[model samples]
Target chain A: MNGSSKKYWTDDPEMVERYVLGRLSEEEKRRLDAEIAECEPCREMLRRETLLAAGVRRFGRDGLRSRLRRRLVRERRSPVRMYQSVGLAAAVVIIAVGVGVYQMFFADLTRPTQFGKKEIVITQGGEIGEAREEKREVRTPEEKMDAPPPEAKPAVRSGAERNVRPAEAAKRTAPEPIQEFAPAAKSDAAAARSIWLLGTVVMETGAARTGAAALSAESRTADAAAPQASPDRPVTLRRGDVRNDVALRQRPLSALPTARRSQMGSARRVETLVETTGDGGLQLTIYTDDVAASELDAASVETLDGDSLVVTTATQRILYRLPPDLFTAPSVRTKR
Target chain B: MAARLFFLTPDAEILDLIRSGDEEGLVMLYSANERMVRVFVTNNSGTPDDAEDLLQEAVIILWERVRAGTFERNAKLSTFIYATVRNLWRARLRGMKREVPADLAERDDASDEPSPADALAGSEMAAAVAAALDRLGEPCRTLLLLYYWEERSMEEIAAQLKFANADTAKSKKYQCKKALERILTDERII
Candidate 1:
């Protein structure tokens, strides 16, 4: 035995056993401490017991402590910190459960009765008032109050309703007060038919009136009466053979360069019937032969009167009437 | 007092420092305790990758608990940290999404190596000692090992393993030693 083990052995057996087994009380520890300071035999015994214990402990030699330490250190630095909120976890569970329960039982409760009633109003045309009245009867007083206000309800005008078959049926059943306006209504209907026919004629004739053939006849008339006309006021009409000449002249041509003019000529040809307005600005009907296609590309077509000026592109609109010096490119221009 | 320090220290201290806002403290805390947490996780049946993930989760939980002032210090700092890691690993086990390999379930008892004197006795001697320990039965062996290896006090060992009192721990310890000695002498391995 070594000196410490021998010293421990020489001391009380109970004390040696207690210390060796690591069960020594504080008092026993203090006593051993005092005894070992003087006793070499007791010290020697302790050494032997410790060796025995050490041999027993080395059975499994894995570096579990160091591994554990390394693991602990790594865990402390992990990035999973974002998901650690218990409250958030609980809240997610609650929301999921709530949705599940709602789907299982209350799903049908959420469907609005007004949706069905609105469909009926649209399909049946003139029965909108009766449908709304029936809807009000079905709802409770509290539901009526809680429901959207009257202004929120969509107003369906009977006269403006299309699908004439349904409208005629509704009108036959309508009250006598509405019947009194039938004569006045017939006159209004006749006027609307006349306007529709006139629109078709004007659209077809405008371009034909400005053609070269018409211009030649006008020139012949002017030449026959040439000497009789006033000398001081010359009626000089510059008739170019170009398809877009009349429309181009009617626009502010100073803004458009030759390249853009040719592009406009090929991409779009405008027909205009110009009449002088009382305000001195010309009343112009600037029609594009390809109005549907050009409207898709252009910003918008605004009608001054019977004349509509179709701006062929967005950039040309910015240069309208404005001097070149005053035109700055808009900072945030959008094109679609 | 040490346990109190371990428990009472807000988990959120590092996070709060990170958020309000000390970026360095967050890094320091993360780097420091990461390995121990991983080992604890692995010991409790988590995969090596799972251990890594769980260690991060444990740290994050610690941070959140500290922030919320919810961490309760009931054990030593190391013990509490190990327990937290263990709890997280246990939760993963219960989830049953994946199988935990058998090797991870084995306890890592090798950290408590016996003293150099015991080591010099050779593997045969160590086996002899373990065989002696086996003869003492569960409670005595448990108390003896916990006393020597874990360095638990009589009160702590009694409370942990749930013996009657400190006196029970002492008597159990004496009996275990006597039993070990008899076994050793009979086997002629001491």
Candidate 2:
């Protein structure tokens, strides 16, 4: 082994490559390892190769480990836990579907049949009764004279009172014989009232109106009721007709009242004149028809002092007296 | 019978006992090789912190390989452990951006009790060696340094720097050594 000329175990290129990648056969590796013990040259070669391989591996490992660790942490802290989460979600979906199926097929089965039957009976009787009342009211002129005066006066006056004062018309038509007619008229009036009540309830709860418009109506109704009950509460105005008007009004009010003279400052365009109150509040008078009752905020009352009402916000410390009828009058449309 | 068997069995039996998930084997291994691993790491241009890190890494590798039944029994356990430490050091060096100085190769000799010649302070031989290395071109300097410091084989030196073959690497190494010797002789350090 000392005088051996074969350098295959010494400086062999294939042997070096195998050693570097750690792919050498056990016997070959054993021989080389033994030779390395006696030979400094072989030892040195092995050291350098080992260093190079380690360095490359370290670089690769550092990049790979960071990426893998991040992925692992993300997976661990995800919104849903891994194992049972899918099953739980599937179960919830199944339950929802089952409930939907039951509602589609057997919903009416759960309702009381007797109540429906009673409603049908009442509806049918109501129609016949209405017809009978109509026939009785339309009797011949000779028999019509026998009809009570209370019933006759309301029917005649309601049509003719437009031309005459209501008090004078009612006085001329009133008679003692009309007492018995009150019950029939009351019943007819009750039926009409119930129809409107049912319509209102359906509009409130039923799935008829949808999208932004319906939501706006709901918000408006809520706002009207809300402020009357509580004054200091914030008013939530959904984007709608009322909101649009208020927003349009607010734009001009919020605008910096510039001294620049333009169409806004012109006398003809200024339909409403604002005057400051003693407390630095404003008074506005708009020359137009009455504003709608639906548009009023019940919590705040606009007093009709001529045609204007004083408005004030303590926080703003600015007073605005605006025309009560400004919104009602035809004016330049302001964009919100 | 148990006493006789225990007496006949070598310390390897005790080591096996420790190796079989035994705390004793871990203690023994750490006690024996910790310093060697640390020295190997430190001497190879690693800081004390880096030494500790490499030592731990090498121990962990050994423990895992042993546990996995992949550790071959050809080499002595200490030698195998040292080899592992050396491999780790080599790896760190290769990974470094800058080349390690060749003076690090002489560190082991420095640690041994100095000979009278070495003990004489500010020796001309040291100056000559430094001057010789400085006079050599970059290629020759690199070749000599890699040869002494890393103790790289001709084949490895060729492959690492992408030489065509081991013969070329050996020829270059021989030329660098001869040039270094000529400079030393001219400086009258040899």
Candidate 3:
């Protein structure tokens, strides 16, 4: 074992490892120790093995410990990053909830297109009075149209609907705001018996047009009534002879067939229209007739009754409720 | 702080990490016993730096045993770690005592302890080997570290480094060790 050419215990890799790891028995260790003292090559081999193990341990320690320390440093700073991420998420959720709450409780539901209905009650004596206007507006058609003829639509009247005020009617009809207007009532007598309303319609304008006019009718009352034609229905406006000078003297008091009636192949352009409301009611719109007011002398006039008159020109209309003629004689002549 | 949280990790997980030769196991053991070792060393005239170095050495000892499949789960991991730290610190303190010339000579002559001259040569050689291992570069560097320090089996080395088999891993390790020795010899570090 001491000779350079002879095999020593340290020449065996497993023996060298077992010796270095202190795994040898006392006798084996004593024998190896004596051989190492006498054997220069074996001693050098043992030293080299020891040094290699030490070097690897140093490298593993430095590398693994540095990584662990870095992790410690990074983790020390992570609480703030976690808070920032959590706070951003919380802020987003809060904003979303705020918007939803505003929509549910605070947002304005009624738009300009929605108009509150105003009921105008016509008494048996032909006196017309309107219900008080409500603060809330009604929801109507997406696009405002001139009143159609008085169509008889059967409104589904619930106990809730029967007691619905103007504001409640607006809410109750909100779901189906743009219902189609039914065909007009057959006659003025039928219209006089139905519920009548005064409404404003704001026409949609082009995006480029900023100042489109909003057309609304002012409610007025008739001050005079014609002689009762029948007891079964209230006396309403009846068309009269246009050429009669005596009937023409009824200042601002004339009417014509409704626009809906005119639309039924009469070929006459209807300047004024009366439409049935969506909820089984009737609506009459008296436009502020710019053409009639500007050309009063040339405005076409026809008789309705002594009380209500519709004065219209080609593109303009005005519904005038003349002063009651209780003091004047009833001289209206009905056209056959 | 998150590393401190790893101190709560159970011993079973740490053992699994050791058996798998995961470096994270070393980190966990180092951190888990860091405070205890710090207190022990500092109370015994050792600084915080000494405590850290001693703890790392102790953990490496455990890693070597665990990787070699020789570690006994006879006690709690922390208990083993604390005892190892105590022993390492005692050894370090004894070495410090031996730094004096008269005591070093007496210890060297009286026992099988290496003489001061031999210790200095050994320290220098160890440093040279470390530098040569660095220059030896990857696969070899890792192979030597796994074999010499972690004492992992050839089969584990093959699986970990994706070698075809344990025989292949053994062959590669032989080559890597030769290369490391070559670097040391060429650099006149041996």
Candidate 4:
């Protein structure tokens, strides 16, 4: 042990760790302490080790504290408190049901029925054609919600709702039916004779109450047709890109986006849909309840306005304005 | 509803949660024992803030012990926490009692207050160490904390971290420690 110079205790890192953590035996601890007092490097090493240990301890404590505080805030916001009183929750549900029932019957009766009679005029070969009206029935508030014109029947039955094609419905209900647009006889001859079933809707305005009903029918139609076309990728239309006045009217005020509400300011709802005629032609249908000035020729191609294909029907002079890109990219159909 | 269930969770389940490193159990422990700690602290001349701080500290101590496998099951977790809180509050009260006026402390030779230089060095050292640990990150930071602060065994650390064995854990610890030392040296911290 008696060399010219003593071998430093700091040479052994394990011994230094043991000494720092107070794990050294009493004799070894005393020897190290004596050496540490004499050696400046040993003292510095010990100090750093001690600081590192304390810092790690502090870091652990701070980390735990932060996590605990965050969890506390989250727990406070959690809905666990809802189940604490089942009676209060039941009472809330009951009150909601009562309000809904009152609004459905009593409130509806008090509301002024601005129900406008609508007629759909279909034209062929870009010539002014007659839309012979047949059996007309007084539309219920429910029918008004659907906003289907004279030709389109309210498909009240769930199964019938699936395929509520206005042209087909008109043919079935109309006694002296207007001539139906001929579908292509075969896929090979599809390009030659394409039929464009242009529907012109005429009506009088009073459309504030049909928001929810309009959305349900519109969404259901979209959902039903979505699988047949573009089954892999769903189509997403930007606001104002495709507008359904009926759906917009039926929409709950709070449910409408701020940007949408601003866009629809002072603009009347004109429901329209563009269906692919299988042979490259487009079947455009318009549904509206706004009062018309005069019935224009429905068959005239000149009726198709700029961006908006404005068709003043044989009865109602209703203008249907569409987004500029509607005809160019006609995949996403709007609900009328 | 879950919060109510947590309040009713037995000590064994709470301990299991601690062992599993679940913070939910710690939260439950913090919440369930809060009233008792507050009552005790307030009665003993402590403020609500003091009670909260003491409770957090006590819960942390319990967490550390349980995680490190050093906590004895002889007493309930709440009992251990309460005892720890009591000890901490007593120490704080003693420290308060030892406080002297600045002038008296300067005159008194046996004062325990750190010199300005020592205080500055201590804070700087703490800051540097913290910075180095942060830079180290991940399993390295946690491994060092488990070893140095929590004083967990290599085997326990291996199991917790899903390492192969104690030897692998020890080797990893060595590598992590060297990496930490390099960061500290690069940053002129150690």
User: In TM-score terms, which candidate is top?
Assistant: 3
Query: TM-score per candidate, in order?
Result: 0.29, 0.20, 0.43, 0.43
Off by over 4 Å in 3: A1-5, A80-336, B1-9, B98-122
What is the number of backbone collisions in each predicted candidate, taken in the order shown? 61, 15, 13, 8
Model 4 Cα lDDT, one tens digit per residue, A1-336: 223276977777777766655557779978888987888877887787777766666667678888998888887767775554566888898998887556433453222212133222222222122222223432222223333334442212010011112333344434212112322211222111212122233343333222222223333233221111211221222234442212111112222223223223243443333343222233333322331111111122222434434432333334443334333433222222
**Poorest 10 consecutive residues by lDDT, candidate 4 chain A:** A155-164
lDDT by residue (A1-336, candidate 1, tens digit) is: 443434443356555645664456668668777877876766766765765565444322122233445655565455554355566888899998887556434444222223334411221213332123244343322122222223421111111111122334354544221111111111122111100000111232343222212223333233221111111221222213211111121212222222223223222233222222222122222223222212222233232222223333222321111111111222111111
lDDT of 3 by residue, A43-132 (tens): 888877666666666666566667767765665467876898889999999998887556434544221111236433222222233433
Q: Score each candidate by Cα lDDT.
A: 0.40, 0.38, 0.49, 0.51
In candidate 1, stretches whose alpha carbon ends up further than 4 angstroms from where it belongs are A1-48, A51-209, A212-336, B1-8, B11-32, B35-136, B150-171, B178-190
In angstroms, give how far residue A196 of model 2 lies from its true place.
Answer: 99
State, as a TM-score between 0 and 1, how close model 3 is to the true structure: 0.43
Q: Positional deviation of A267 in candidate 3, in angstroms?
A: 91
Give the per-residue Cα lDDT of candidate 4 at A172.
Answer: 45
Q: Which stretches of candidate 4 lie over 4 Å from their true place?
A: A1-11, A18-35, A82-336, B1-9, B94-124, B156-165
TM-score of chain A of 3: 0.23
**How many clashes show up in model 1?**
61
User: Where does candidate 4 clash, by residue pair?
Assistant: A203-A290, A204-A289, A204-A291, A210-A250, A211-A249, A211-A250, A211-A251, A212-A250
Q: Can you give the lDDT of residue A329 in candidate 3?
A: 16
Q: Between 1 and 4, whose lDDT is larger?
A: 4
